[model samples]
Each structure stands twice: as structure tokens, then as C-alpha cells.
Target: MPSLVDYIIYTFIKIDDSLNKILEEYDRPLRARVFKPKLSDSEVITMELIGELFGIDSTVGIWRYFNKHWT
Candidate 1:
């Protein structure tokens, strides 16, 4: 059986792939005044999911956790 981390990664990949497909189908035009974000929408969403899974209640907590554990 795959490890828990491996399973989590696989799930995240599937979610990200689905999100990309949906975005491609939508094909929404970008606002003229809005600049491109450094992080992709999928990436931000993945981080949010990770935070929730780990019971992180605040954005700052999420950032701190990621900084310590992810990076």
C-alpha cells in the first residue's frame, strides 16, 4: 500500500489536473488591470487543502507551517 503522504500527493495531483481542465474549458478572459499571480490558482488551492487537513485555522499559521515543513 502507498504511504499516507503518497496518497495525499496523488489526490492533490488529481484535483489540480481537474481544476486545470475546468479552467481551460471556462476560458475566462483576464481583467486588463489584474496582473498574473506568482502562484497558480491550483497551487493556492492545494495549500488551502493542506492547511485544512492539518487543522490550520489561520492564514498566518498556514504560512508558518509551510515555511517550516514544506520549504
Candidate 2:
């Protein structure tokens, strides 16, 4: 069985790979807005997916869990 950390890492890898493939298919560069985000889109998606998979409902709950435990 995979541990929590394993799941998180796998999710991130899959998301990042998918995003890269998508960008390549469209021939578009990843452009940031006026302000860059602290985390990448893949990271954010991984966090959200993990949170939902584990039944974490609130954004703050997800952030706190990852911040305290994963970080």
C-alpha cells in the first residue's frame, strides 16, 4: 500500500506530466500573470486532489494539513 507521502508525490508527478504534455500539444508557453504564484499549478492541483480524496472539505483544512505535515 502507498503511504500519504507516496500518494502526494505520485499525484504531483502525474499532474505535472499531464500539464507539460498539454502545453506541448498546444504549442503554448506557460505564462505567469502580473504576480507569480508561490506554488505551481500542478502543485495546487495535486493538493486539491489529495484533499478531496481524503475527504478534506475546506481549503484552509487542506493547506493546514499539507503545511504542518507535508512541509
Candidate 3:
């Protein structure tokens, strides 16, 4: 069946993208993996961007959570 989406898709498919050039970016280190589905450096920074996203900022509070979950 004919549709607007099909029309747009076909138009872009005929366009040439060979003229475009892109630069490479630096690779992220493995130690930055902190959450499920693990994220990149920019993503990891965003995760902690929100104030108190982890809650209870101090070291003691963090240690308490670690102790409860670890031993």
C-alpha cells in the first residue's frame, strides 16, 4: 500500500552520502562501566549529573550501602 512514510523513505534512499566525511573519536576505557547496559564517558557523566541521583552523598552513607549489599 502507498503511504507518506514510504514516499519519504524512497526519496532518501536515492540520495548519495559518499561525499560526507566524518572524524574518529577516542575510545572509552573499560573501568567506566558502572551500571547495567554499561555506558560511555558522556553517558556515565550524565548518570551522575543529577543532584543526589545516588542519594546520601557522604562516604559513610556510601559505605553503609556497600556493606549492606556486599557483606
Candidate 4:
């Protein structure tokens, strides 16, 4: 079985690839000129996926888990 870190990396890559393809086809801007987000959409999605896989049901709990462990 793949390790947790490996799974996270794989998931992020797949999500990013899919998002890029959709963006290319749609040709739409995801953000404005200023106020960039701290994390990319793919990163956020990957984090949430990881949280769900590990049974983190609350948004606050997911944030706390990643903040404490990922950082």
C-alpha cells in the first residue's frame, strides 16, 4: 500500500491536472488581480480529500489536523 504522504502527492497531482485541463478549455480567470489565496484550489481540495479519507467530518477539525500535522 502507498504511504499517506505518497497518496497525498498523487491526489494533488491528479486534481491539479484535471483543474488545469478544465481551465484551459473554459479560459476563465479564477481570481482577480490582487488578494491571492494562500493555498491553490488543488491544494485545498487535496487537503479536504485527505481529511475525508481519514474521517475528519468537521471543517474546523480538518483545518486543525492539517495545521498541526502538515505544518
Query: What is the C-alpha lDDT profile of model 3 across 1-71, one tens digit per residue?
Result: 75744643443333212111211232543354456553333332322332134575755665465457535
All candidates in order of lDDT, best leading: 4, 2, 1, 3
Please list the residue runs of candidate 2 whose C-alpha ends up more than 4 Å from where it truly belongs after superposition: 27-31
Residue by residue across 1-71, what tens digits does model 1's lDDT show? 99867865886798789887777766573323367877666667777787888899888898788779867
What TM-score does candidate 2 reach? Answer: 0.80
Model 4 agreement with the true structure over 23-71: per-residue lDDT tens digits: 8866567665578889998999899989999999988899999999999
Alpha-carbon RMSD to native, per candidate? 2.7, 1.9, 15.1, 1.4
Q: Considering summed lDDT, which 10 consecutive residues are worst modelled in model 1?
A: 25-34
Using lDDT as the measure, name the better of candidate 1 and candidate 2. 2
Q: Report, for all candidates in order, the number of backbone clashes.
A: 0, 0, 0, 0
Estimate every model's Cα lDDT from 0 to 1: 0.75, 0.87, 0.40, 0.90
lDDT by residue for model 2 (1-71), tens: 99877878888999999998888877555775889889998998899889888899989999998899877
The regions of model 3 sitting more than 4 angstroms off are: 1-52
Which residue runs of candidate 4 sit more than 4 Å off their true CA positions? none
Q: For model 1, which pairs clash?
A: none
Q: Which residue pairs show backbone clashes in model 4?
A: none
The best candidate in terms of lDDT: 4
